[model samples]
Target: MDTHTPASHEVKLSLQTDLTPAQAEILDNGAQQFLEKLVQRFASRVPQLLAARETRQAAIDAGTLPDFLPETAEIRNSEWKIQNIPTDLQDRRVEITGPVDRKMVINALNADVKVFMADFEDSFAPAWNEVLDGQRNLRDAVNGTIDYTNPENGKHYQLNDDPAVLICRVRGLHLPEKHLLWQGEAIPGCLFDFALYFYHNYQQLLAKGSGPYFYLPKLQAHQEAAWWSEVFSFTEDEFGLPRGTIKATVLIETLPAVFEMDEILYSLKEHIVGLNCGRWDYIFSYIKTLRNHPDRILPDRQVVTMEKPFLNAYSRLLVKTCHRRGAFAMGGMAAFIPSKDPERNEWVLNKIQTDKLLEANNGHDGTWVAHPGLASTAMAVFDGVLGERSNQLDISRSEDAPITAAELLAPCDGERTEDGMRHNIRVAVQYIEAWISGNGCVPIYGLMEDAATAEISRASIWQWIKHGKTLSNGQMVTKALFEQMLKEEMDVVKQEVGEARFAAGRYDEAAVLMSRLTTSDELVNFLTVPGYEYLS
Candidate 1:
């Protein structure tokens, strides 16, 4: 009998090999001495492979190791490490400026935030190259430099070297469009592009630990988190920073991550300084993951279940997980953006109260705001905490994108007019409506719905506005404008679509826009008025 072991390039002969008379004749003629050598070697080592197979089977049978992925990395508890200095809104709050030609950032910074984030991932309509360029601009923005002006009235963008704080949201992990953007421009990979962009552009702005960082998007799978950690940590090394020095905020937006929150935190605890629940994605997750389960659903989403027992429980768990672990459990966004019309703003005020009540019970330490208008509201609501002696972002208020409402509204003509504001608002509203009515498969005016379409209109449009879209109509909505718009539209949306019906885990019109709104400054200001004090 003859057996052979395969070389890296050659095939192996079987362990038990018997040659017929004709075969023996060929072998005798020396078909290949290599075959004989391989057979002898493999015969001697066969026992080792068999033992390995038996051990793996035994581990599975004993339920000690996963039948699959037994060799994967082991899970471990994570640590939190981000500097959080609490400052009053009046004392300090950074703004979001530039690109939009709006003073939203400067105003916000001057008005009520402890930190300002220049959004790129969910705001800009960065078709690949645009993303690269936008990021470079953001790098400049971080250092108190940006070619910016208020597009509406010809005001200039201004940032102080001593600005409160600045942060940015990069393209979510593995976003396919990033690849398209890079390749179309003859680059190899978007990830590489992003990392390089951060490196080369910040040549003059390098800080010992103060270089601009990121807000991660679409972070669901732990592997994805690990992948990003690797990329970020690697980038830090290449850029000449201390290992693990880069800080990030995680926007939990997928089904698996919501349910696996504990593990996700443990996986990212070390690098994650802040964790925010993403409402649109959270609802999307509920629909995508929990809706299928009959026992865990709400009677409908229209009933307002962001505070239901289940969500409350989950939120509490997230808050506890983050807080107990020393991480900042950041509350999700308040898309209602306060309204100018006090009545409508009052309604959002009602929602914000509910939102605040739920958040307070959970152990969250901070909330997000989308507009400068919301800054005052956030100040009023979080005044107690902001006024407190400790240093931390006030979690008492709230913080909070999107496709064309018409799916057909071209992004914008770059001109300025109040009508442009109406157009963009209408597009956002239409997008929310269409997504709710199941007309989400395609743009309201264009092509069929698929992954590409969803990404283009749904994801792309949202990012564009986030980055600060200029309208032909002359009106604008910026991260700074979010609060102002919320107040403006709160009444309009509620009055326009009365009593939205959501099936527990479904994304009704309200849920879809719950965290994606930016109407007119002053997000649900009612949260701080007498009856809303509990919101804080």
Candidate 2:
């Protein structure tokens, strides 16, 4: 990648890829200066925090387990609450999320939901064009001029008069914006995503009586929360917006993050509204964070539902911590897509309702859905529990017993099956193929799968093989057994997708990558980190 420096900016901004006229407009002189300032001021600290994560992981690997921080006990025991949430965010009974594609932006915002999280993380593939185009799409959406025309069906899509409140989710700290560099190094991808969106849309959003709302992902500690708080403060000051003008909801996704929920909220209390249970990634984190614990090997990904002891404890603790601190306790994602068959669709709806009802009854203010078809079913569940209330923040679980570290780390009990192993191979391969092809959110086997779910699929298989676990049929999981299954599953995938489509797609490459990931001598922290090299 060659570097191009725009002569207009005093601060040196290096670009690895040539930008078109439209892309240049999005990164014009002012935006370039802002991004450069962010990079110089805070980008250096990202790696330090990331290193801290590794240090903690090493301790866990060396037989020490994560527990509440002794130093932050004062903060947790103190009485504090985050700033008042914006009126637009108070009634987030149902939020729909998808990538920032034009059609998805229009449809998701137009859907009958309270909020639409325009994702640049798990559901997005960070190809240069895709990233820049996503920013353009979001700009149009905020300006109320976004529309899409599908060439295949000759169908047009536009936002309705009353659309859902928009929240943007940036990439996590571990990823990089490979196309852009600051001081000859790639800037943090989160900064690139946040700076562009906020610069372009913050003014318009404020004019419309809303703020620059965000969903922060994959923070393993409260210090990471403090870093974001500083960024929000700096941006607000630079733009002359009032303090607390920016709001965020942190995803309590990682295992370490769950242990610091109160401290995380305190660190960003001036600019936070809540925390969400990013259940899929949390499960993947559980496996990766405890990779060496032989006794903690998880069973099939299908059997590891939220009802498990550890997951249930995590959920209850999140609600108790968030509501006690006067913030919303949001629930996890419902990833089921509606089926074409009437009976199948009914079954899907029933499953969605059951999952959402559990969240609502457990006192969550809102929940997430992947498809617009699921909004009403999830909304109905929340509606029944909330009535006219915007949230159930008052239902603090004070009477419940305190959740312990052992409970949170409890090994899940379930039987591993050959069918389950086969399913993981198929899903992981298909998802990786779609992702490398510049599509991250994919529909497979009647479910909306993203990078997080795919991570669980591959990581589960790796952990099982590492522990030499036996399946329900008494077949031991090994590298050789997995390789044989991989070959069989690829054949199944080829037969299902047909020879022509299979050949045209990246199935073979995906299969190769899957085999390497599952059989590698050491566990990969994130499949996306390695897989990103294959993206354009």
Candidate 3:
């Protein structure tokens, strides 16, 4: 369904759909020479990385417990810290994350936050148009020309003269950009996003006294960090930029990454900036990592808050580790999108304020907000704690008590309930429909749910059914039970969204896709893989 043709240069672009000249220009800007070089250098290495992932997954499937790498013990025990973080990346008190939709990009940059992580991963549904257009928007943003006009209200949006620091989050290592191929294989979406952005914007940003900053996603091993370091070095050499110009914040989203935190930091120390509390994916990863252990099954989604033993250990350990090693410790998203109801908005903002207060008190340098409206409320919390200080890396919270493996793997106590099961099914269906329709982040039940939360929702259902988890109502969760629950939830969704929009978004197909994911005999590593197949 994609067509290839030369565009503004010798390099051929695989065009999946027709593009306007301006859109084509964004793609063609430095795309020719840059993409060719990247494809030639990194194409062969994609398989090796993916194969390594499978090997680790196979071990998990076989009930092998992942531990700190023995070979990297020396690195972990060392007193070394990551290289100095840049000024712009130092005090990320509030970073708003979203897909690179034009309006979202404009609003996030002008949201008066410390940083804006323009996301190409969980927050985005990577259809071909979305990917290309996202790149264009980022370029335009860097150029200070990105803007949007609301067709409904005739309102215009643009960046502030002084905007938030921009940090781009590329696709995770596991995703493949099926639309683009090199050496007879689809290139890794991570590579495509990183290479294109660095190729086009590294020098441009450098001219403005900033550089290409990034948030690395879903890395399960330190080798992936090392691989990224090599890529950064390669980019610097190829582009004639200074070494260490590219700084990255790694999302400790996977369970294995939690155990290997020190090693991951050491591996990419020169290029590392911070460690983010990628709470949602970490929850999904916890379930997947311990899939073979029926005893490790989690409770209802609502009960698995960060205050739980396992989550608490993870957060405390991250802050301690990053601070001990002289790096910023970022907190997770407060996924509340302000509602239209004043009472609801006030309640949600108050909840976010308390959540952020915990992070700030725990010594997190910054936190994330889903909506622009919550930025002020979230920032007030961090600003109170971090008064006149860029970060609390000077505070050594680990000195009193260090985190142990047992604590990180501590089991939670709660009962699975019928309400929880139905909630997961409902969200899985609604979020998937939105994602399939090219909107990855959708607020349901007052929480901004993205692919990460959807993964948790669907994967929990699969795990519950696989382990025959019993609800509080004395009903055992089975495939048939889930199917029944799913149908009931579909009716709820239809009633909520009404007939026309639900049909337009193709919720029927999304329901079938979600059902397949939730009831499949084998677990799929990432739902986006299958979900993307239905796009375009």
Model 3 CA lDDT for position 70: 85
lDDT of each: 0.43, 0.92, 0.85
Alpha-carbon runs more than 4 Å astray in model 1: 1-111, 128-133, 150-152, 160-164, 178-193, 200-209, 294-302, 386-429, 432-536
List, residue by residue over 89-173, the lDDT tens digit for candidate 3: 7778889999899999999999969899999999899988888888989998998888899999999998889988889999987
lDDT of 1 by residue, 1-536 (tens): 12222234432232224445643443332222333332232223323433443464345334332211323323323444334322222232123321211244455444466666555444333333344444545445555565567568986767654554655565543322323222133111224334434543334434423544456765655555655566566555544655645566677765445444545555555455666666555554443332223222222123424655445544655565555445566666554466667887777677666665456445566566555555555545555544563323333222211111122111121233444333334344444444333222223222112121222222322333444544444444355454455446545545554545323313334323533433223222110011111111
Per-candidate TM-scores read: 0.54, 0.98, 0.96
Instruction: Order candidates by TM-score, high to low.
Output: 2, 3, 1
Kindly report the root-mean-square deviation of model 3 from the true structure over all alpha carbons. 3.6
Error of 2 at 74 (Å): 0.9
Q: Which candidate achieves the best TM-score against the true structure?
A: 2
Native-referenced Cα lDDT, model 3: 0.85
- 200-305: candidate 2 lDDT, tens digit per residue: 8888888898879999999999999999999999998777778999999999999999999999999999999999999999999999999989888888888888
Best-matching candidate per lDDT: 2
Better of 2 and 3 by TM-score: 2
Worst 10 residues of 2 by lDDT: 1-10
Instruction: For model 3, state the Cα shift of residue 196 in Å.
Output: 2.0
